[model samples]
Target: MIRPVAVIGAGPFGLSTAAHIKASGIPVRVFGDPMVSWRDHMPAGMLLKSTPAASSIDAPRRGHTLADYCAAAGISRLAGVEDIVPVGTFISYGEWFQRELVPGLERVRVVSVDHRSAGGFEVELESGESFTARAVVVATGLSGLSHLPPELAAAAADGPAPTGPVSHSCQHHDLSRFAGQELIVVGAGQSALETAALAAEAGARVRVVARRRVGFGAPPWRQPRLRPGSPFGRAWSLWALSHYPQPYRYLPARTRHYLVRRVLGPLGAWWLRDRFEGKVRVEEIDRVVGAEALDGAPVLTVRTRAGATGRLVADHVIAATGYRVDIAAMGFLSHGLRTRLAVSRGTPNLGPGYVSSVPGLYFTGLPAAASYGPVMRFVCGTEFASPRLTRHLVAAHG
Candidate 1:
């Protein structure tokens, strides 16, 4: 049996966890290609909804901040309309951060994780190698399955999910693929609006579809009301997101769920009555309820608030519906280990410092999201999650 100090995914959260654990002088083994999903899955030309300062991951060393990297690259630390967080820029920063801080990433995909008899974990990878770690931290972000509405799902199975005709906002890589075709985008969150903009720029007849009319807003996460100046901020202790552990990191998943749905969710959608939609067609209060093959191409059956059904045919369909964290979907969570881990709302339950209810099984990144609010799901969330998680892991082993 191989038991390591820790195991983690290699996105910002995973790398940050490894960095903190390794920095504490503990032996850790982490798996996954660093930033592979971020580099590939996220659409280009999308600006981060949250600005740089509000979305910082924790940095153990003073100079490891994105601000520092920006300074070094002659990029402004401040991200404005002209300069936004490019996936490549953040991907490069993650790589540089890995090289500088978390050098333990194995650049391999973990296939399965099993439980050892002695209260430890066994991690098997795509390379057919195995590692034993006292603790295994699952940080695989966005690698979870992206779900589509029933209509879109049916169309995807019949053929290629619409290309220029329709596409899930999540699966799109190139807007040019929809060039010169009619497109209808679903959702009004940043992804939907941004993808709509991207498609329109590519010469496609683009229309945005949303269940409710959504107006774009500057992600209010940075507003003075949400920041340190507010008493609410002081109570939540989120003002130290870049430097300290999130207070919710230790709270129960149920508590966090309430906080997120009641607090963060409304706040996330409250901004943008008059931003981001520049000449884009937004079909407010519409939903895609069905998809049928119209002469071999997909046609979306649309339902509106008035209960009337209409159709929007495109060459493709892009579902920008957000991802869901089903514990059973994690590629590396073997049946044996998955059974052993505690469950919280269909996810592996985690505690403060990202400790799983199952000993030796910690979670980082998206897996920690329910308990950490929206914080653990973002790149910047790593900054807070790492040091707090590492301190406990290091103390236990070091």
Candidate 2:
């Protein structure tokens, strides 16, 4: 009898890992819809921050790059940083990769994961089916992990679902729904900036509130130059971290945590700056100190950089504050199983090969960022994580 490895997502990291495992001749089962988050969560008309070459799902074999997708699709292939890749194109590329390499991927959701008495994991599906696997990779993307600030989170906790005035940016797909309404978007990151632009474009009265000033990414150079570095950023620290991910695992936890939080802190793409210049109102150096529901709308008390306090009322509040990895928040894990995994703060403390404290259970993607480095947060990280994890799985389980 052969025990297969179970992968819990079909996004870039999940697909990349699954393709590598399949190529390694190991039995693997991939669950979830391909590009589900990108397709469903993000508003239309968004562009990827990474360049075309870097925005690739690592194929066990060659020729599955984003450039290849553009060529095969009869679109002019992107050559340098000048060409921007849209989110829609990337979603199409992911689905294409799944079709070409990772076949028979189950689109069903894993409802629960419990440790078997003997060994391995018993995974129950939403379709009323169950199976045991030698290993399980919890690579589910940003779903169930959207982070809202304490004030907004408290207000959201009282709502039935995402219909509440206070909600995370992840809960929205189309900004057009907020047309002709007043909306306050929190955070200066790409998600916040872009969503604010989209909401304004969709006819919403929008204001962006952030604790710190905004920083936009540099635009592509008029003349393409070959500077060897990581796609993560132009900084040497980012370059080093992207190139040598394994060494990051050996760094002190404090250093690792600092890099994870600061290295990739909030910034919008250069192209988006023009959109927010005149259209969206930006309240920089201001933080949402408190939130309350008044007359069925969200009223936010904000503190300015100068220590002055003010209030702003909006029909909706979008918390683009980003995600925090909390192992206990994973609803699919049984209480007993969740308690068994080790964690530092909300993040799982992963060992080499991306294995968690619990044997044979693994974590990747954003959740792996704290342990593996900042690169784990992006699509390019899959290039490093997939092959290494595949080798580990093959040697240990195959």
Instruction: Pick the TM-score winner.
Output: 2
lDDT of 1 by residue, 1-398 (tens): 33466465677787778777776767777777887777777777655655555444466768877777778778757544223466667777788888887775787777777888976777777889876777777777777556666767776664334343345555667778778877777776667777777777787777777776565334335455544531123334445433344566567657776654444332222233334356478776556778766665668788878889888776656677666677888757777767777877766667767777776678777767777766665666765678878877766645
Error of 2 at 225 (Å): 7.2
Error of model 2, residue 316, in angstroms: 1.5
Candidate 1 residue runs with Cα over 4 Å from true position: 1-3, 79-83, 158-167, 218-255, 258-278
Residue 268, candidate 2: Cα error in Å is 1.0
Work out the TM-score per prediction.
0.86, 0.96
Could you give candidate 2's per-residue lDDT for residues 1-398 as a string of tens digits? 78889999999999999999999888899999999999998888888878886798889998898888888999888867667889999999999999999888999999999999899999999999999999999899898888777877655657423478798887788788899999989998999999999999999999999888877877766223455456854656777888888988788888989889888779988778888889999887556788888877888887888899988889989888898889878989889988998888788898878888888888989999989998899999999999988887777777
Instruction: Candidate 2: list runs displaced more than 4 Å.
Output: 157-162, 222-228
Q: How much lDDT does candidate 2 score?
A: 0.86
